[model samples]
Target: MSSSDIFIGEIIGTAVLILLGGGVVAAVVLKRSKAQNAGWLAITFGWGFAVLTAVYMTGSLSGAHLNPAVTLGIAIKDGEWGNVPVYFAGQLLGAMIGAALVWVAYYGQFHAHLTDREIVGDPADKAIEGPHDTKNTAGPVLGVFSTGPEIRNVWQNLATEILGTLVLVLAVLTQGLNDSGKGLGVVGGLMVAFVVVSVGLSLGGPTGYAINPARDLGPRIVHALLPLPNKGGSDWGYAWIPVVGPLIGGALAAGIYNIAFA
Candidate 1:
C-alpha cells in the first residue's frame, strides 16, 4: 500500500474499531444503559466483533494494523521500519477520534454516571492515588476507553500484558499473516478476533487485557484531555505497562517466530 493509503486506512479503521469496542464498555458501565452491568462476556464479544469489522473494512488498504503492538511486531518480523511511524500516527489519531465520538454518543449516560452524588469528587482535590485493592474511585470512567490493573501490582500487571500479547502476535505470525504481517485475511481476522476474545476471557481479570498499545494509550490520552464532568485522575502512573508490555511482547514474538516458527 502507498503511504497515504496506509495512513488513511489505518486512521479510519482504528477509529471504527475503538468506536464500537469502547461503545460496548460505555453501554455496560455507564449509568442506566440497557446493557449496564452486562458483564465480561458481552465486552469480550463486543471487542471481537469490533476487530472483525475494522479488519474487513480496511484489510485491503492499510491492512488494518489498528494496534501499535501489531504494527511493531510486523515491523520487527519483516525488518521494515520505514512504515512504522505512519502506521503508529494513524492508529493513535484514530483512537483519539474514536474516543471523542464515544463521548458524543454516550454524552447523556456520562453526565448521569458522573453526576450521581455518591461517586462525585473533585479531581483537583483528591489525593490521586493509584488503584489499590480499594473501591475508592468514583469517576474517570477511563476503563471504558482503556485498560487498568485490578490489583495494581506493577510487575504482575506488566507480565500479564506481555503474555497475552505474545499469544496474540504469535497467533498472527503463525497464521502466515498478510499486509506485511500487519493484518489478517477474512478467516484470519475472525480467528484473531476469537484470539482477542479468548485473551479477554482467560487473562483479562487481572489487568483488563490491554494487548494493544494504541488501544489503551490513545483513549487514555483522550480521557486526560476531554472535559468529562468530575472525571477522576487519568492514572498516568500505570499507563506505561500497557504500551511497554505490548511492545516487549511483540518484539519477543517476532524473535521467537524468526528463531523457531519461520
Candidate 2:
C-alpha cells in the first residue's frame, strides 16, 4: 500500500475500532439504555468483536494497531520509525471522530435524561458538595468516556492500569504477531480479543482497563465539548496513568519479547 493508503486505512480502521469498542461502553453506561450495567463480560466481548472486525479490514494495510501503544510496540519491533507520527496521529484523530460519533448517536438519550446536578440531589447546587456526591453528577459522562475504580486514589489506580496494560501488551507481543512454528492468522485476532477479555474480567473493575490513551482521552474530550443534560469535570486527575501505563506496558512487552528471542 502507498503511504497515503496506509494512513487513510489506519484512520478508518481506528474509527471503526472506537466506534464499536467505545460505543458499547456508551450503550451500557448511559441512562435508560438497552445495555445498561450489563457487566464486564459484555464489554469484553464487545471489544473483542470490535478488534476482530478492525483487523480483518485493515490489518494488511496498516497492521490495525488502533491503540497508540500497540503502534509504538510494532515500531520497536522493526517497524519504520518515520511512519510512527503518521500512524499515531491517525489513530488519535480517528478515535476523536469516532467518539464524537458515539456522542451524536446517543445525544437524544443523554439530553432527555437527568442531569448530573440532579442525580447528585443538588439540582440546586451546581458545585459538587462532596466526593461521594461528585459521582452522581459525574458518573454518566465519565462512565461513558473511561473507567474508574470503585475506590479512588492515584497510585492504586495507576498501578491497576499499568498492570492490566502490561498483561495486554505482553500477550500482543508474544502471541499476537510472532514467527512461531505455528504462524499467526485468524487466531491472532481471537487471541487479541481474549487478552482484552482477560484484562476486563480481572483488572477492569479498577480504572476501567482503558489501556489505550486514545480510547480514554479522545472520548473524554468529546464528553467535555458535547451538549449533555449535565456534564461534570473532565476528571483530568487520573488521565496521565492511562496514557503512561499503556506506553510503558507496550515498551516493556517489546523489550521482553526482544530479550526472550535474543
Candidate 3:
C-alpha cells in the first residue's frame, strides 16, 4: 500500500475502533446513560465488535492494523521498519479523533456525570493517593479514555500488561494460517476480534487490558486537552506501564513468532 493509503486506513480504522469502544465505556459508566451499569461483559463484547467493524472497514487499505502494538508486531515479524512510524502516527491521530468523537457523542452524559456528583460520584474521590487514604482533589474520568490498574503494584501492573498484550499480539501474529503458512483473510479479522474479547475477559482486570498503545495513549492525550468539568487527574504516573508494556509485549510476540513459527 502507498504511504497515503496506509496512513488514511490506520487513521480511519483506529478512529472508529476508539469511538465505538470508548462509547461503550461512557455509556456504561456515565450517570444517566441507558447502558449505565451494564457490566464488564458488555464492555468486552462492545470492544470486540468495535475491532470487527474497524477491521472490516479498512482491511483492504492497510490490512486494518489499527493498533500500534499490532503494527509493531507485524513490522518486527517482517523485518521491515520503514512504515512503522507512519502507522504509529496514523493510529495516534485516529485514537485522538475517536476519543473526541466519543466526547461529542456522549456530551450530555459527560455533563450530567460531572455536574451531579451526588448521583454520579467523582472518580478521583476514590483515586488512591496514600496507602490508606484517598485524595479529595478532583481527578479526570480517565478510565473511559485510558487504562488503570485495579491494584496499584508497579511490577504486577506491568506484568499484567505485558502478558495481556503478549496474548493479543501473539494471536494477531498467528491469526490465519493458510497452506503457505501466511496471510489472514476475513476470517482472520474476525478471529482477532474474538481474541481481543477473550483477552479482555481473561486479562482485562489487571490493567484494563490495554493491549494496544495507541488505544490507550491517544484518548489519554484528548482527555488532558478537552474542556470537561471535573475531568480530574490524567494519572500520568501510571501511564507508562500501558505504553511500555504493550511495546515490549509486541516485540516479544514478534520474537517468539520469528523463532518458533517463521
The pairs that clash in candidate 2 are: none
TM-score, per-candidate, Cα-based: 0.93, 0.86, 0.92
Clashes of each: 1, 0, 5
State in Å the error of residue 208, model 2: 0.2
Please report how far candidate 2 places residue 65 from its true position, in Å.
Answer: 0.4
Please write out the lDDT profile of model 1 over residues 1-262, one tens digit for every residue.
8999999999999999999999999999888799998999999999989999999999889887888888888888888999999999999999999998999999999989888876565342233336241332544377877888767789999999999999998888887376455567777888889999999999998998989998899999998898876676688888999999999999899899999977
TM-score winner, 1 or 2: 1
- Candidate 2, residue 144: lDDT: 67
lDDT of 2 by residue, 68-177 (tens): 77777767766457777877787888777888887778776576455533454444322222264444454455666665556676788777877887787767767776
User: Candidate 2 regions off by >4 Å?
Assistant: 116-136, 178-185
Q: What's the C-alpha lDDT at position 61 in model 1? A: 90
lDDT at 18 for candidate 1?
93
- Cand. 1 TM to true fold: 0.93
